[model samples]
Target: MKYLLLSIFLCTLLACTPGSATKYPYTIRDFPDSLRTDLRKIVNYGFIGSPSYESAGNIRMQISDNDCKRLALSEHPILRSLALDILCNRHHLDHYSIMMQHLDDTAYVNWYYQCASFTFITVSDFMVKEYKWYTEEEKNRTVEKIIRDHNYLQSAYEALHKTTLTEAHYPFVRKMAEKETLMKFRSEALLHLAGYKKISDTGFLHNALYQSRHELDANAFGIMELYQDPFYFAMLKKYFPGGYYRNFCKKDFERNTTENALSYVSALASYRSEESAAILEKILFQDPLVPCFPADTFRLRQHLYEVIEKNTCEHYSKMLRVVKPWLERERKESAENGFPIDTTSFYQFPSDSTNPPKIRW
Candidate 1:
């Protein structure tokens, strides 16, 4: 019994040692002391009435229940950054060092933006203000930091995926939309600005949206459907008329460089215009870029069809018009492969998923 107790004592001692931290996921023990300290501060999420909870400055924020989950449990590296992203956003704590640095690996940046907490921060920053947290000094400093990140351009852009611009940020997005050196980045800024529904300078937007000389600028083309400006239609008529929507750089999608074209498709579905239906139809037949999409071609087309159906009153004509061209293209393409599709079993959206009759693949 005495020997067994000694063995247990030794085991506990070893586990508590600094070297043991590596045994935890994410090699947490190796993390810098300061980083760990910051994590500790956040993981210690204050209770509802506890002193750990930060009171408001000019505003009080009732952060969502989902957002209130404390991050103290997980020791993963990405989760640590996410915890920081959430807790800092909730408390209005400043200094987003890890995610802002361009030198950081793709895993950290991708996860930081991909996580739910970051989305909340982006959407909530503006949303909660309608009801808001943080000291005046802290809020000002945080806003200043955001401006600094914005000035950093690409770095800021990556981080912005995990954050959103508030009313004050509308001006920043507006200026960037017009003055940014790169047309693609300018288009991105334009999209961000448009989300606020406040861009009034049609002349500037038209010039930026159509002035691009590239064979395909996803960022610029990406925003055309949202604004749906007559100028965009004029530009589309000259460049792509009668449902010709195939200029997304497939290479960019493979490179994981940017959101690229699949994002363009997601945005396209929201557009109800006849032009949009034509474009969606072209891709529905076959998008070689399906690997980059959130879903397979079949599923994507199904969703697009549903969206178009919802948007247009002339659903049957629009569906037939779009499908006719796609079917013809498919027949030619399938003939080349010597394996033509059976048109008898065409794809359609199941308006009622619960119906057992519609469950066929």
Candidate 2:
């Protein structure tokens, strides 16, 4: 009789915990039938659609303050996050205490905001819901919390990166970029610094790039590309040796070697130097050392052409003249070969009804 009583007591305690199966149902059918219909709809289908903001906003409006508070008790992280959004955005209630309790809720939620859907942890969803209204001190504390907890770093940064950050936040961001062991977070921090254009240190970008390895290289190159500093011209040039961007000629398509080279190509193209132009001209015209399929070459050339067209310099005048005829020839060949012919110009130049403009380059 005592054993039976003790077993029931233990089961009751487990059922009441935050992540218990009874508290947080694994299936929709397991959720209590008594839940309000509107709240259930938000929890079940809120993450759908490409840009889900309109639908989500409408659903958020139907939740009452009382109903929204009840949602905070749900073990479903998405529903809990929805509750947080309602409390702050609709009712203008203080939900910081509730948010603190959910800081460790690492369950992923795909939230719709600003005409785009982003997948992030439940804590970040609510933090983002309330971030815009936070005072400076509150914002600082939020950043500190993100720094102290790795779980919040990526998702919180995604939601907060565009918010108005002043000079005071630079050091905190820089530390994460340089010192954080997680490359994804470090890369995000590096891009944040570049995006804000607030870094005071001259050597920071160079050092960051120098230290980057493997997947981090793409982001480091992206930072340099965004910075647009002529000082990195020599470093950019090193990537374009042997008439093509590094790794562009690799035979292994599975490794995506050529695709990965696009970042380096784009970084180099941002420079207007004669050396840069000459290298790119070779890339545009020369046959590869290791031949790719004709289709692959055409696609690669088209991508290269788009980058070149966008960043054309006086040095590219000769190359541009040669390119027009080559592209016209390719278009004719594609038509004869029964491939679908694109009506747009090879470089996607805007067409005029009569007499197209000469030399946009």
Clashes in model 1: which pairs?
A: 60-132
- Over the stretch 1-361, how does candidate 2's per-residue lDDT look in tens digits? 9999999999999777745655444443433454455445656675633344444566576656765666655666766666665665542566555555555655667655444545444554455545443345555565556554642346545523545656666766666666644565577777777766754655776676555543435566787687877656666665556323335444554343555467766877787668889888767666663254423555667667667766878988877786666667877887888857686747866777565232100
Instruction: Give one digit per residue, the lDDT tens place, for model 1 in 14-133.
Output: 877754244324433444453454334433531111222233110123433232232212344333334333543543343233223212222222211222323222222221122122
User: Which numbered prediction scores highest in TM-score against the true structure?
Assistant: 2
lDDT over C-alpha atoms for residue 241 of model 1: 25
Which residue pairs in candidate 2 collide?
A: none
Model 1 CA deviation exceeding 4 Å by range: 1-144, 148-150, 159-164, 181-184, 196-200, 213-222, 238-296, 315-361
- Candidate 1: worst-modelled 10 consecutive residues by lDDT: 102-111
- Measured with C-alpha atoms, the lDDT of residue 340 in candidate 2 is 71
